[model samples]
Target: MASSMVAVGLALAAAGFAGRYAMQALKQVEPQMKQALKSFPKTAFGGGFYRGGFEPKMTKREASLVLGLSPTANKVKIREAHRKLMILNHPDRGKTHPDRGGSPYIAAKINEAKDLMDGQK
Candidate 1:
């Protein structure tokens, strides 16, 4: 009877270990499956638009307005406009003045404008 009990106990331990290993394997596979799903191309048939390889389009007018400069403005004027706009739209100042709503977007737009204008020169 003691031998039978030992056998049963060993069997139970082995089963428990197998179960734990199976669970871990499943856990690892779940993430890989999720990653594969995410990497899959979005399809219109799946009720999703293709977001892959798409970039935001910017226009010269939008850039000039963002930097607080006229569209006809030159490189030197663009730089000056960006400087002035940055002073008002800086995120640090927005932190102190909660009404400004943390002007990071404006700051980014200003930087984009400067980059576009500088590129044109």
Candidate 2:
């Protein structure tokens, strides 16, 4: 297996398609990643390396529903909901509190939902 991977690597390097192949592999692994990478500008906003953007696909309504908030929910309500949900679902909390098994994806989704809602307001 090691030798096969080394040979593949050498072949890709010789073909001068290593970076492109790697990026293509990344695209396959993460279907949603292509949009973010495709939108990159030549330079970053703060005059640094342009780290790619992370635009979540969840719409405002979807995000609000995920957080159990109404579409018209204000920032305070959103903030409170996010805090409560994070505490209840956080991974660290799982170790300390078994009843609440840590859910990293839920936490991340909650954050994305908040971001989507926040941007609208």
Candidate 3:
């Protein structure tokens, strides 16, 4: 019991010393942090768009826009939008394809857009 009490007292003293040191360190850092924050862009911690193949490649707004549908669109509307967009963007539609010789890239993007939008279904 005596040993335990000594250990507890040592722990409390160590903790108090550590806390005091941390408070002093924070006070030293506070002005520099304030200055850095003042120079930081307003977009910090917000309005971040995911990129570089990370995750969440398509936000709801982006998927909807790609499919030419509203964000609140139903499956039927999404399907219709995807179909209409695909008709114009399909790569092998051949002559009179609007793109004339439609590119595979556009078709892939259209298909991806459809898939993203239809994911909810």
Task: Estimate every model's Cα lDDT from 0 to 1.
Answer: 0.74, 0.75, 0.72
Lowest summed lDDT window (length 10), candidate 3: 43-52
Q: Number of the top candidate by TM-score?
A: 2
The per-residue C-alpha lDDT of model 3 at residue 111 equals 72
Model 3 lDDT per residue over 1-115, tens place:
9999999999999999999999999999999999987886643124354344412466766676566567778889888877887787677776655556666876776677677
Which pairs, if any, clash in model 3? none
**Where in model 1 is the C-alpha error above 4 Å?**
1-55, 100-102
Per model, state how many residue pairs clash. 0, 0, 0
lDDT of 1: 0.74
Q: Which ten contiguous residues of candidate 1 have the minimum total lDDT?
A: 46-55
Could you give candidate 2's per-residue lDDT for residues 1-121 as a string of tens digits?
9999999999978777867888788878785666777676543223353344334677776776667778788889989988988888777876866776877787788888888777743
**Candidate 3 accuracy as TM-score:** 0.46
TM-scores of the models, in the order given: 0.46, 0.48, 0.46
Off by over 4 Å in 2: 1-56, 96-99
Per-prediction RMSD in angstroms?
A: 14.4, 13.8, 17.7
